[model samples]
Target: MHSEHPPLFLKIAAWGGVIFLHFPLVIIALYAFNTEDAAFSFPPKGFTLHWFSVAAGRSDILDAVMLSVKVAALATALALVLGTLAAAALWRREFFGKNAISLLLLLPIALPGIITGIALLTAFKTLNFEPGFLTIVVGHATFCVVVVFNNVIARFRRTAYSLVEASMDLGADGWQTFRHVILPNLSTALLAGGMLAYALSFDEIIVTTFTAGHERTLPLWLLNQLGRPRDVPVTNVVALLVMLVTMIPILGAWWLTRDGEMVAGGGK
Candidate 1:
């Protein structure tokens, strides 16, 4: 016989971990509404929406937000295309250097962000590529591709190859089969991967710092605000916005993929 429930201590430990990770976020949210701007205090002075209005009127915040959104969108798009193609090529195929290729694909994301950022910065300098918007997109796409590739390839492994064969046997052309059969089966995985990739890119600071030159994405702007203590309330508001933007997509991705093993046309 085995226990069906975790021990009480284990449950307590789990909840403790959750609180430790998220208590700071709760504090950030509380501070976003704090009326006192000088320094963060316990229990918060009082609640007001003044900071939200202040953030709204700031052109720099708006510009940073817009840049972050644009970079995230473009990076996700690039990741979806490249990652899907890579997964399709590798899913049921065995060839020379396949494992090596897979390892290379995952290396960017597996390494530390600072390492990846440094490597990208060095490569750009070698190639005489200016550090700016395009570099930022490329840098972001490198890791974003890994997120999409993992999601899609996992789905591919679960999916039956016979679906493609059956479509062909039913007089469907390659494009038609892919459009009608494959796309539907891949829809959730692709969407989840895209959302995850977008969220990752949107909040990324290290790689963007190395590649952005003078460009300020939302994360960079928030980082710069650290030096301006007077902007604490506005910074809190922006931080809350960033958290919401990243967290929502992450939650959406989790919801989309929670039942992923039961994907359409899966199994033998």
Candidate 2:
């Protein structure tokens, strides 16, 4: 039996839309090797490792990359802990204002990025807190938690209660049950959550702007590159590098969460 699909026009339109969306990225990746001066000429005049070498020795770019990695790692770890706890609490029992709590958890992701950035800035000003690596981590974690929370909550909802109860019946204490059983069950969700957190932190610029007073991350570095046209192709190289750095975690998370099968033997 043949299953009905979208019309030919719709299929073409879908592919067209994808191409329109990603054409610039393709260009950026291709021009990374162009040895020509500042201009990004198609069919690049000559291929060279100048920019790649430049990116390697550039201390500022290296520092930004290091900062970005630190922020993403910290944010992901913090979000994993907080989000997992929140999910566990919600899964354990029903409570008053559950919907409100859940909505609040989701607000950071739902609201405009500018709004979140501004809000973080305002809060930091009110607290008289200095914007730096710490601020960046906090800012990223605020949203990262939601990514983790969403994944864990969905996983918990589908989880069988019998498993936890069985662990308890086998004389497992709360911490032991969680460490051995619950944590294992949530391993995949936690992994997915952390990856999402890392990816989100990697590309985040608006919030970083509010939180970063002096130190620059890779995204901020890229933003600064925009003012100088001479470094345009160099920017493309850094952009490609940035994309690769962020892409791995998101892809890993997608693969892990897509099936949710890995979580089956989690706690044991």
Candidate 3:
């Protein structure tokens, strides 16, 4: 038996698309080590770690980094619980509002992020909610939940319900059935989803714009650093650092979800 793949031209086009998408990030990584302080001059004159040290010394950048970490952690934690619950409910039941509920859960990820951000901003304004760290976490969680929900729901669909039934029949209550059978089956999905949620929350800018009041994330801080000539090298260093840190969780999620195979291995 032979595995089939897309046509050569289509494959080339797909790879081309990826290259086009990632080229800027590659360029940024390259320029980050450039010894020259001038504006992104290509084929940099030299390379050094001076800029990395400079980035470390910047007080505001450190604060922004800390703020981003806190927001992403909170958002990821909230997304894990809500997304998993939503996924479980959607997977286990058929009801009158099923489609609508599913659509609403997915809307944040499916819609243009700018639109979601704007709508969330408007809703918050209407509710007279102050923009702050909490607001940022809520904004991020709204979308982050979608990421986790999709992953967990897909895994839940693939899992065998008989195992859960067996557990329940063996004098295990619902919570016990979940703890042993269902939760173990969902471990990989939950891990992958949390990683995805963290990644999304870390770099999100549009929603953060609406929700972040007097709070700067790393991305926002980078935006601010754009205007300063002397800070250029340090900004590059920080950008590269952010890219590396952000890429880890994103790649981990991709690895876990690659084949969509629900890991049957139960936790110890």
Candidate 4:
């Protein structure tokens, strides 16, 4: 028997859809190197690395980048911890309202960013907790946790609980069983989840806006730069840089999670 290929028209449509979605990102990257920086010009006059130097020299941009890095790092860490514990508790368990509990765990990411932001802002105001870096991390973590949770729970379902039992039967303590058996099984999933959580937190704007207050993350800085028309090229350079940074982790996560068994688990 011969394997069938997708129809030519279907292939063209798929490529067209991908190009349509990503072509504008290509445009932004191209304009980042444009010599004519007065405003956007098609077939950019020439290309140069001047804007990259300009972006590098700006302290505000550096600060914003650093702040975004910090927030994303912190949020990813919190998400990994919370998500792993939640997955461990909820996996292979029968309990009351389990589905509802799982739904609540997922609610933050499921809701619109605007809604999440508003709720966070309102809660902060009601509690007299000022919006700032910590607030931003909290807001980002709420959604980031969902990503980590989903990844971990999928892994948990694929894992063989019997291995854990066997480890215990062979004289392994709870910590020893987890350290030797469970941790190895979860390492890749945890890494993938952390990378995804980092990527989401890095580029988040809406929740960041409400919780950031006077704190300027890279996305907020980019938003501010948009108002300065002459600096648009520099902004493009920064945007390109952000894209590159986020792309690595997103691609890494995808690669790590690509194997069915990787997301699923090793045991049957």
Clash-forming residue pairs, model 4: none
Worst 10 residues of 4 by lDDT: 259-268
Candidate maximizing TM-score:
1
lDDT of 1 by residue, 142-180 (tens): 999999998899888878999999999999999999999
- Candidate order by lDDT, decreasing, is 1, 4, 2, 3
TM-score of each: 0.95, 0.93, 0.91, 0.94
Residue 179 CA displacement from its true place in model 4, Å: 0.7
Estimate the overall C-alpha local distance difference test score of candidate 3: 0.86
lDDT by residue (106-159, candidate 4, tens digit) is: 999989999999999999999999999999999999999998998899888879
Question: Which sections of candidate 2 miss by over 4 Å?
Answer: 37-39, 260-268
The local lDDT score (0 to 100) that residue 46 gets in candidate 2 is 75
Instruction: State the lDDT at 28 in candidate 2.
Output: 88
User: Which has the better lDDT: candidate 2, or candidate 4?
Assistant: 4
Q: Give model 3 RMSD, 1 decimal.
A: 4.0
Query: Which residue pairs show backbone clashes in model 1?
Result: none
Which portions of model 1 miss their true places by more than 4 Å?
A: 36-39, 262-268
* lDDT (Cα, tens digit) per residue for candidate 3, span 110-132: 78878988888888889998888
Q: Candidate 1: what lDDT?
A: 0.92
Could you give candidate 2's per-residue lDDT for residues 116-220 as a string of tens digits? 989998999899998888999999999999999988987887879898999999999989988897788778888888888899998899889888999899999
The order by descending TM-score is 1, 4, 2, 3
